[model samples]
Target: MHPLADTYGRRFPYLRLSVIPACNFRCTYCLPHGYRADPNAAGPLSLDEIARLLRGFTRLGMRKLRITGGEPSLRRDLTDILRTAASVPGVERLAMTTNGSLLTKRLDAWADAGLNAINVSVDTLDATAFAALTGHDRLSDILEGVDRAVERGLTVKLNAVLLRGVNDDQLPAWLDYLRTHRVGVRFIELMQTGDNLDYFRRHHVRAELLEQRLRDAGWTALPRAADAGPAREYLHPDYAGRVGIIAPYSKDFCAGCNRLRVTATGDLRLCLFGEFGIPLRALLQRDEQIDDLVRAIGGQIGRKEKGHFLHEGRTGITPHLASTGG
Candidate 1:
């Protein structure tokens, strides 16, 4: 099988496909308050288009598939998408990253469709604080979904974006809650994605500080196998769960980056922080050879930016995180 490798020799076996770019909530660090979906913009990839792309990637040795979105559960044909992805011949794992607001009722359906793992975004457990941060009072529903995912025996992970004065203090509670359960919790550092520049600058907490806190609490590094995902895992001897950090801004997390991002609109993103993308959706309809299309994608993969543009003192790209699978 042909492996998807970049110029830097990073094999791109993982594909993060955004099924939809419209989400239900507006978390402070992600979407701006009162954000509305831009109706006039072109729609996301159709189901057929998504399947074809996944198949294409599979031929290039993509074994791990992850579906992300504004909220992946909100997609009307989520189950069909999941099944199609899982049916890909060599796809060994199918997973999703969702906000959990719409997951309580769909968790079972998702798992049955070959979903092997799930990562839910829950910044705070406090109801009022959750509502304040997300501009929604769906905290109960979310946590209930999290619990239901656990009960179903699905591999579960909780992602909490750590904001210095906001929910960073909840780390201990997050760890305590994970003790008996096998669910892992990852504390993400707030990123300077588009539109939330000021908020990111003001509230962003360093992952190092949180890691130090974990060490102080007696959390020890758990040796991970080579194929582990982005999170750097740690744990206390007595806890069944693990704690992790996904820090994009703290340092160069781009080296050995082995994933390719497909924006909701079917644009192939070479790098998360770069706007240069090959428009795969537009090319799908052309009567061209699939190999030619794949070759063009390979060219861009070789040109993947060396790092987040911030390395050169640039700000977020033109597109919003809601539009990309960030």
Candidate 2:
């Protein structure tokens, strides 16, 4: 059995699966121009393969699943994948992270297919700035998509990547916008990944500084919500929802990391920044028995590193967050 340790020695229960490596937008910070796609990268996993892996994982005591991708909505059968995953014996909650451009078309269907919640990436509210950041001129589309998601009764959270000269000044405004719209906003610190490492180093804002700025804006850090991530969350006494900061670079939360990631091509990553992953595709292709699959998974978990070392730098890695299923 895989003895995954929690605060009280509890086995890990959450899994983040990246269903595809294809994205609709090329965010400047995520994957700038000139980045070449891998010629030998495997295609997306079949729905059956995804279902089989989830079944094995659920049997191993996983209950929460978050579907991510280059942009998970880019997948044609994403609803089917969500439905199959939800049908697993022990899987209880199914969530997804997307760029939100295509969510308008799939929101209701995804909800019907067992998607519980969604985290939408919206860096700024300005149309011109949005286009500059994402290499797409579709701010109106993204906004409409968010509206559609909320209208469908989907719990929506806005993910804002806070870069210094880029969108730092808009933090309060973003929070105000989400509050007026009754949506949650999360501020993510720029990590040293993709082509934005230099930009991140130059404009990276720390959580402490962010909190202080919020204080200056008359907000106070509140006790974090139970389901919240590493983001130190805050609330304006007058706002409907809350604002949070995810400072992965300034403050690492690897010890409390209860999640594992499965890349679209079927590589199971133990941690977000971990160097290696276990290949589930090969094992599935070999038609490994259920019991054997479980053992292999458990062994991989045993070898899971304590956490990722981002300071070590991406010396030879080439996969950006988008292609890696972030």
Candidate 3:
């Protein structure tokens, strides 16, 4: 049994590792304008380093892993990284989260490299709106990428960031689109953090409102089947897949939080909205043994804050989502 089991006795084994910190598109909600480019920001965890981390975590009973980034596809050695991760012992599932910009050409390769599933960040269907949100008019590319992922038999999930006035009206359209495509659609509520506060004041769409709208439109919202991430999932009455609502601001799911994040720079974050983390890069550089790393990870997990107190005037402690692993 893993030593890092939480209060509910659930083993905290899953890890979301960021392979790169820099992104090609500067989404308005993610990064602010005049985003200074950090030259040393993106160099990834080397295949050897990642493999070592994977093996070490598995040794401590980790079974699930997800690769994420500003855009994991931007990594030149992404395929190699996936292959290495898939071969790790005790890693039952390996997944990735990407912007879907380069997925059209790389879907087959990613699947062949043993990537188990994929989550694509797709906020709006309108080409103009998408371009405005991402700072790049690559809507066609993203759509094609989604199609290719489905064709390659990958579990495709569309991650939609619901901004109040910007794309809330597009929710129903996205649901209709997903019904025909047979993929999951997740609606994420914007959280106030870093540059997000500037955007959230103008665009925070609460999940309760979205859920009510869907029900009013004659859709049934079902409870989630498992203890997944922060996303509270629901099944539309006639829809094949599911719809997930991640309301970090409106309703926090801190008690059920099961995952942890490892940044590209090698900081292990216990919670997506938490401030505390330990530098894994320094430990790795010092060759501190695996058991020591596991103990450190467990110690960090033990101190996880109950939840993000957004209603209690909490705003700026959490790191940007892009840098913290999607």
Candidate 4:
């Protein structure tokens, strides 16, 4: 099988596929006004289309597949999607990112369907702050779900967007929880999107500060895996859990990019903040179109920009995180 590589010698072995566009929470940094469906937008891809897409990706050396969404759990057929991903040849890891609202109720079924790892968005440990940030008062339930996932033997991680004067000062709280959780909690730097200029200016925090704090507390930097996502992880002898920092604005941030993204409607995005997407739904419609799908992906990989223009204050067409499953 031909590996998916770019002109700069970066090989992509990870695929982040969005299965749905609708999310339930209204996170302050993401969908602050809640999700508003676009009347003219096409619905999400069908199961058959998803299967073909997965097969095509697997044929091109994709070893890791992450099912993302505005909230992946909202998809009624998510279990089938997970099963299909697991059935695909060459897919070594099958994971998903969710808001964790439905994890407690549906995690076991998802695990049975082949989901082995999960990343849940938990902005804060404080219940009131969580409600204020996510427009949801389900922190307790979500935490319970996290515990359940750990008990069920699934590799679990938590994502929290770092916002100044918001959840930024909660590192101590996170450290306290990490002392026993045995999970990884990544603090993602708030990004500037097309519609969040004002909010970005108000709350964006550099992840470097957090990393330094971790270092001061005796956290040792861990070596990154070849197919891992863009998180710099740290480990501490006193803690069972790990700390991860995702700083998109850091120098040479895109140099190690090893993943590609596909939207819910089957559009390939070379970069999270890219100016446009290449439509791939037509090729995904039939099993016989796998070759064309593979070619389309392989062909586009060469034209991927060396890096995103985010540092230049350009967010491209990404209006919000939800639009691209962040």
Candidate 5:
């Protein structure tokens, strides 16, 4: 079969799989009130199950798999998960998004397990601000983990959520760190998603403003990075690392939508701004063959919403970003 193309003809060669929906730090933007998963909440798909699913996706032409979570490092089986994902036949890349609290101890193991890339979420350069923002004081460890990953030659990316009144003022401090570092830094735009509208309304900074600031300060847009991922890549002549801006609100952000999401619980969210989902775990549990799974997923993709609808001042999406696998 050909690659999985949605109704709009955008082929999805990527999959964002959330293995665990529970996180330790309650980042103000994502979990303002803090979080505590239900003690009885069902655990995520098993390692074997996840491997099998990846094989099926690879069979359907998926080339990259990004493992995400409330915090992927929190899972004890993460190394195993990475090893399994890397072993998939057609998976050309295996990456992860993590908070880095546990990365210090596991970085070597993960690198050895064949994780091709890693994106660590680091919103501020100040330790106090980080604790205030995420309700945790592990900033040093997070930074150290990034340094270690760099030393080990891992393709590391830093994801910073630039909240206008929050960490926007720390850009210089962040840029200083980047000047000597080889890791790419991506400044992410705050979005109007889930129960965080109030936060979004207060802190959302348009990437347009950031772009203008970068140019004023001497950074030039590099030919859009070769990745074709959401972030638009840029560069500064003086800096050793690349810069990126992910503007979900901007008109061009969703133009080439080539990805789909599966929650830790197996909910197939066709679009980030929509709540409609096909319970993939149910189908998988029923022992439906790969063909059936593909048919069901293809039909669901055909129903992918035209856009995230943020332009209309509505995110219709209600699940917390963490729960939905951000």
Candidate 6:
């Protein structure tokens, strides 16, 4: 099998596919005004297009496929998408990241469709704080869904964007939840996007502070999996669950890059914060174009830079995380 390796010899065995860019919630850091449709924007990839896309990537040694979105569950054909991706011969892990608002109603159906793992966004456990942060008052219901997901035996992980003076003080509460539930809670450092400069300055807290806290609490660092996302995970003997820190701005954050992203419109993003995307939608229209599609992808993979310029105050073309499935 041909592996997708960059100039720096980073092999990409994982792929994050964005199914849609429209999200329902008005998260403060992402889309505070909610989703505004672009008049000239094309609709998301069709099921057939998605299948062809997956087939193309699998040929290049993609073994893990993570379906992401502004909120992936919003798609009407999400189950079909999941099944199509799972049917890809080389895709060993089929997972998704959702906001969890619809998890309780759709978890069983999704699991039946071959989704073996999931990451749910739960920024805060407090109902009031959650509503304030995400513009949704469904914290309790979402947590119920989290519990249900764990009960269903899916590999469950919770994503909480670490916001200063917001949910930063809630680690104790998260730790308490982790003590009993065998789930993984990840605190993502708030990142600066093309549009959220002011907000990023106000809310972005260094992830190292939390790392020191974890070290003080006796949490031992855990070894990373070959296809894992950029998270420094830790485990504690007293807790059933684990904690992870996704510090994008940290030193050498992109040194171990092993995943590539495809936008909802079928543009290949070599890096989430890259300067541009190479459109692959036309090639995905027919099965006959697989060879050309793979060539285009491999050619671009060689151009990936060593790391993102996020530290230099450049977020590239990414207006927000939703646009590229961060």
| Model 5 superposed RMSD (Cα) | 1.8
For residues 1-326, write the lDDT of model 2, one tens digit per residue.
33345333435778888987777787877866733557898888998788778877877777888899888887889989988988888887788999888776778888998887789999899899999988889889888988887877777888888888888888657766756686778888777764656777887777567877878887777774333456677778778777887877564466556677788888878767776778888665544566666777877776666656776775224357775666
TM-score (C-alpha, index-matched) for candidate 2? 0.90
Q: Ten residues in a row with the worst lDDT in model 2?
A: 1-10
Clashing pairs in 3: none
TM-score of each: 0.94, 0.90, 0.91, 0.99, 0.94, 0.99
lDDT tens readout by residue for model 4, 176-242: 9999998999999999999999999999999999999999989999999999999999999999999
Clashing pairs in 4: none
Global Cα lDDT for candidate 5: 0.82
| Residue 95 lDDT, candidate 4, scale 0-100 | 93
Model 3: residues with Cα > 4 Å off, grouped in runs: 1-3, 7-10, 39-43, 217-227, 285-288, 315-319
Q: Model 5 reaches what TM-score against the true structure?
A: 0.94
| lDDT comparison, 3 vs 6, better candidate | 6
In candidate 3, what are the lDDT values of residues 127-211, reduced to their tens digit?
9999898898988888888888887888788898888888988876787786778678888888777556667789887877887
Per-residue CA lDDT of candidate 1, range 1-326, in tens?
68878767778888899988888888878775644778787888888788778777777877888899878877899999999899879888888999887788888889999998899888887889899888889988988888888888888998888888888888767767888878899888777766776787799778888888888889887774433567778978888888988877667587757788898888888777785767888655543445666776767777776777754546446355666777
Write down the lDDT of every candidate, Cα atoms only.
Answer: 0.80, 0.76, 0.76, 0.94, 0.82, 0.94
Model 1 accuracy (lDDT, Cα): 0.80
Candidate 3 has its poorest 10 consecutive residues by lDDT at: 220-229
Between candidates 1 and 5, the one scoring higher on lDDT is 5
Score residue 129 of candidate 2 by CA lDDT: 92
